[model samples]
Target: MYYIGIDLGTSAVKLLLMREDGKIENVVSREYELSFPHPGYSEQNPEDWYRQTLDGLKALVSVVDPKEIGGISFGGQMHGLVALDEEDRVLRPAILWNDGRSIEEVRYLNEEVGKKVISGYTGNIAFAGFTAPKILWMKNNEPELFARIRKIMLPKDYLAYRLSGSFCTDYSDASGMLLLDVKNKCWSAEMLKLCGITEDMLPKLYESYETVGYLKPEIADSLSMRHDVVIAAGAGDNAAAAVGTGTVGRNKCNISLGTSGTIFITADSFCVDSNNALHAFAHADGHFHLMGCMLSAASCNKWWMDNILKTDRYAKEQTGIVRLGENHVYFLPYLMGERSPWNDPMARGAFIGMSLSTSRADMTQAVLEGVAFATRDMYEAAGSAGITPERTMICGGGARSPLWRKMISNILNISIDIPACEEGPGIGGAMLAMVADGKYSTVEEAAAAIVAVKSTCEPEPELVKKYEERYQSFRKLYPALKTVYGEL
Candidate 1:
């Protein structure tokens, strides 16, 4: 039998078809528009996500017998607030995870409500992009819409609801919502009160691989699939990607350098970072994990290549960067206002330490190294909690660059592995569906059986030493400019 994994991403929806044995039969993706109504606000229509996913699903299953489809699940962008009215109509465009429109609300949660109190309830502090802050933004800015919210969900859960009529979410996705008591696996009463909402407004929580319901007859028929297809509650993108890379079990790690960057490390037991720098959340493997998410990663490179250089030849831009750790130029990858560590929405990107001799190659090298250095900040935060992993599975657009991967390996002084299956979250979503269909007893067993590493990048000692000295200088730039950002 075959299972389908639907990846509802920021820019598009990708649907993958795979057998129970982990052989991918077909993959299809359909693009959608992302709206930016204000300078810092990011929004998307829920209808666009559903319509494109339906198109992608038909394309994915066209080569196979639809009756062979066993189940369907998802891996999606996390923490986007998708609100539904009493009649199940979308209230507004979903406020996405990277949106920074809730700056004031975030400040209220961290400063007024207090970080110690919020962290105790949800195992995390408020970020400008998190759902809890968005919830407050709605309450303060649009009380009429806030009053009509009958159901609140993450991005993929909205898809699950549209397909299965379950109105459910998985723990891994809900963890970023700031409404879940992550350590205990339930809704946080204090947070609900803070957001002026009731528990009934939230969806029922499930483990990532648990079955929500059978797909609705009409939805299944529309895609030429079985009406009895199991609908499994899936995970947030990072956790699902971690599962795809086999970064489950105790002390496993994965680094993603996509539109956003994250360092995910799984744990059998719950652990919190004292500074609340890293998110302590539930994992898809029925365990827990620590994560550090930075707002801009590979997008920094995209901005540099597309906007500044006016060329799409990303590899060509890197080919000239010969001086790796020896470059005196530096860049700050906070174009979207950093999340992990600093948690400052006012922070802005900058280029420093440029000399008359600084060439285009030097600036390009700085942009790539800047991302690695910011990620290393999160890596060390994990170290503070005694959760250091010797190696990590690498994924997303940035992982394809050998120069970037080598920089990461030496800068963080850890090995990086490329997964044989480059599908990432989509493959992990299929693995969850496979579990729901009884192909495997657990997510861990499915991951261990399906995930494979293709190659590894090891850190060079001399290069590591040079990057370490550079990183120290890199860390200082943010602090010096932080006041300047606020003044701007």
Candidate 2:
């Protein structure tokens, strides 16, 4: 039997067909437009997502025997506000997870409503990206639209609804909405009241591997598949990516350096930091995890290489960077503001300690090292809370760079393991479908059986010592600039 994993990303819907044995048979990506009507707002058409996903599925399964395709599932960008009217039509463009337009609403939830209260209810404080704040923003700014909402869904849940004819979301994805009582693994009435919503507006929540329903007959027929194709309620992108990299079980970690960056640490039991710095969300493996997200990671390097330097030769540009931790140049990786420890949307990217002697190589090296240092900040935060992971699986586009991986390994003083395949959430979503179809018993079992590590990068003691000094200085820059960032 075959299974399809749909990754509903910010830019596209990536569909992957995998055999029951975990071999990928086909993969297709369909791009869509992302709209930004305001300075910090990000929106997308939910209809575009469904249409592209349908087209991608048809292309993905064209070569396969339809009878052999058993199930479909999704791993997607989480916390996007997808509101529907009484007849289930999209009410407005979806406010995406990266959208920072909810700063005022976030402040209301985190400050006026009190961070302690939110932490007590959701195990997290407010962030501009969270769905609840976005809900508040909509209610206050666009009362007419808010009044018309009959259903509220996350990004991937909308895809699941279209495919399975069921309004549903998984625990891992719902955990980010600031509406779930994460510790209790259910919706929080207090949060719902705060957002001027009811529990009925939310989708039914399931575990990541649990089947939501069979595919809608019409949808299945269009793709030449069975109507009874099981649709598993998959996880948030980070949780799914963690499953893909075998970052389940206690103390396992994964670092993603894609358009955005994240440090995911899985735990068997639930835990939250005192400052609510790291996100306390449900893991796809039916447990818990702490995540620290930085809004920009590999995108910084992409901007530097593509937009700033006007070159496509990333490898060649990086080749000239020799010194790992000895460079005096420092960069703050806040191109898209920041999340995690700072939670400051006003923060901006910066380059400090640059002298006349600094060359192009030094600046390039700072970009890589800067991201590494930011990751180390998350690592230190996790350590502060008694969750110490000695090794981590690195994923996303930035992990492909050998030099960057080496720098990360040395700077963080941990083993950086590269996965056999770095497709992240897309692959994990397919694996979840396989598990739902009875190919595997548990997420852990499936991951342990199929997740393979291709290479391991370990830290050098000398470089680690050098980075230790640099990190101390790097940490100070943010504090000194905090007041200045607000003014800017």
Best by lDDT: 1
- Segments in model 1 whose C-alpha atoms lie over 4 Å from true places: none
**Residues 1-488, model 1: lDDT tens digits:** 99999989999998999999999999999999999999889999999999999888888889999999999999999999999899999999999999999999999999999999999999999998899999999999999999999999899998999899998999999999999999999999999999999999999999999999998999888888888999999999999999889999999999999999999999998899769899999999999999999999999999999999999999999999877789898899999899998998888889998999989999899999999999999999999999889999999889999999999999999999999988889999999999988999999899889998899999999999999999999989999999999998
Instruction: Report the error of model 2 at residue 163, Å.
Output: 0.7
Whole-model lDDT values for every prediction: 0.93, 0.91
Report backbone clashes per prediction: 0, 0
Q: Any residue pairs clashing in model 2, and if so which?
A: none
Worst 10 residues of 2 by lDDT: 218-227
TM-score, every prediction: 0.99, 0.99
lDDT tens readout by residue for model 2, 1-488: 99888888888888888887778899999999999898778899999999999889889999889878998988899889999999999999999988998999999988899999999999999998889999999999999999999999998999999888888999999999999999999999999999999899999989999999999998878777888899999999999999889998888999999888999998888899767889999999999999999988998999999998999999999999888889999999998789978998888899999988999999999999999999999888898889888899999989999999999999899999999988889889988988888889999998988899999999999999999999999999999999999898
Stretches of model 2 off by over 4 angstroms after superposition? none
Top-TM-score candidate index: 1
